[model samples]
Target: MVVAIGLEGSANKLGVGIVKDGEVLSNCRRTYITPPGEGFLPKETAQHHRKHILPLIKEALEVAKMEPQDIDLICYTKGPGMGAPLVSVAVVARTIAQLWNKPIVGVNHCIGHIEMGRAITKCDNPTVLYVSGGNTQVIAYACNRYRIFGETIDIAVGNCLDRFARLVNLSNDPSPGYNIEQAALKGKKLLPLPYSVKGMDVSFSGILSHIEEKGRPLLKSGEYTVEDLCFSLQETVFAMLVETTERAMAHTGSQEVLLVGGVACNVRLQEMMAQMVKERGGIVYATDERYCIDNGAMIAQAGALLYASTGQPTPWDETYIRQRYRTDEVEVTWR
Candidate 1:
């Protein structure tokens, strides 16, 4: 039955998930939210994870209708995430491994998303667009590895949106990005923001600065509304992402596109990508908020795959947290 539990606390969210034989039995999560104009700090985020991880773990186990004895393996994100939050979750994973006497494996955060997306959507040989607060890349599977075809040269697409939301003092109740998405729905006129796409790689910093300079003064003068600012910015950035992803698809000769990551939940981004993919006669696959956003089940799924293929758990000494883990660094032997 090969049951596994995954611990994920890469950024503001902390999640626990239980999976058995590639099926996610339970996924529980808690998020740390800052004020409208602020972003969650590493220290604050780590504290939030620490306070809720134990309870969240219990919830996941109960929800999955399983006990610790049934769990064959434990998984934790060995990351490309904030140092404090990554360490906080990794410590818990290690502790539980010892307490439960179960095998443990450190999973790459990005690969976790890819594996879950593939498992849920059942897409084959798809060009992946991984967009999140901390990362933005167009990737393709090749030679037993998920290769990065293109990536952000500066701030990520999510970072660009969050920063712009912060600049406009958008509500952060659910998330700054969600708030911006909502506000953008009422956007009337498209603003002229820089569309920076240098071949496969995209840049968002210049557009962010340009929006601050051009949008802020007009907003203060009542010349532009928040909706207008959000709408224009979203349009510009998503277009850049779609363009680069298309380039990767053409280069890889792929007929399928899979969107995975926090930003993958955005409907507008999905629509834009779908339009482009349709023109190319390709399929576009995406999951809703449940699987797209950061969570534990994805890690568990990926970890279980690794354990199944290699039959070796990560040694305690080698299970250290990696703050700058790259997507391309992982070897996908399970494929």
Candidate 2:
């Protein structure tokens, strides 16, 4: 069996995981939590990853009960994230590959999420809704690529929620999105917010701006609680997501809808997507936070698939990270 260890630090969370074939042996992650209303900066997030990466890697190895020499390849997320954080983990991957004398693969971060979702859920050739802090897209495999059928034209869905949390000074403990979900549970009213959907793409920046303006006076006057704003935002934004996903499903004639990425963990979004798919005699495949959010195991899984097909590692100079790497840029060799 081909064994690989993956390192992921493209965002705030630092993760390490081991995968053999399609099975995940271990997935470990440590998130960098900032104070209330504060967001993680790229430089600081990179520093956090650098500090905790070694321990996390050791922990993953122990959990997998495998030594470095047992691993055949190493993988790291090479793109679509903060430059500093991507480089932080890339440096570590290079070190490990050279020390262990194993081949290395640089996997696309978005493709990593999709591949991991498919592997864990066993949903083959499903339409993927990848919603996260940095990305929001409806993807489907076609013509040797994961083509984007729909996406956000402005800010991503997760970024909209996180920024709203900051406006309300919400705790960033578990996650801004998680906090919003909880607050939404207690919300009884749905305040009006802008909903912009052009063709297959969504726009969230306008809604965020509208909510900030409406929420400022209401919050100060005690006319509306943060809970109401959270509820309204979730309802409006998730509806747009569901609508766009439904359109993609209709266009692609897909019977399965798979949710991947950090924001995919939201129960409300899942419920909305499920309801929409159910009406069309389809099913929605979603995983828990472990597989949904950014992690190393997914990277390893995607890298392993590509490695199996190509039987080659990325050249030392070509392993550098790409900040704006698009999902279509990655050729789906395994599929």
TM-score of 1: 0.99
Deviation (Å) of 83 in candidate 1: 0.2
Cα lDDT of model 1 by residue, 1-335, tens digit = 67999999999989999989989999999999998899999999999999999999999999999899989999999998999999999999999999999999999999999999999999988999999999999999999999999999999899999999899898888888888898999999898988899988999999999999898789889988999999999999999999999999999999999999999999999999999999999999999988998999999999999999999999889999999999999999898
Candidate 2 wrongly placed segments (more than 4 Å): none
- Please give, for residues 67-138, the per-residue lDDT of candidate 2 as tens digits: 888899999999999999999999999998999889999999999999999999998789999999999999
Q: Poorest 10 consecutive residues of model 2 by lDDT?
A: 188-197
- lDDT score at residue 329, model 1, on the 0-100 scale: 94
CA displacement after TM-score superposition, residue 55 of candidate 2 (Å): 0.9
Residue pairs with backbone atoms closer than 3 Å in model 2 (clashes): none
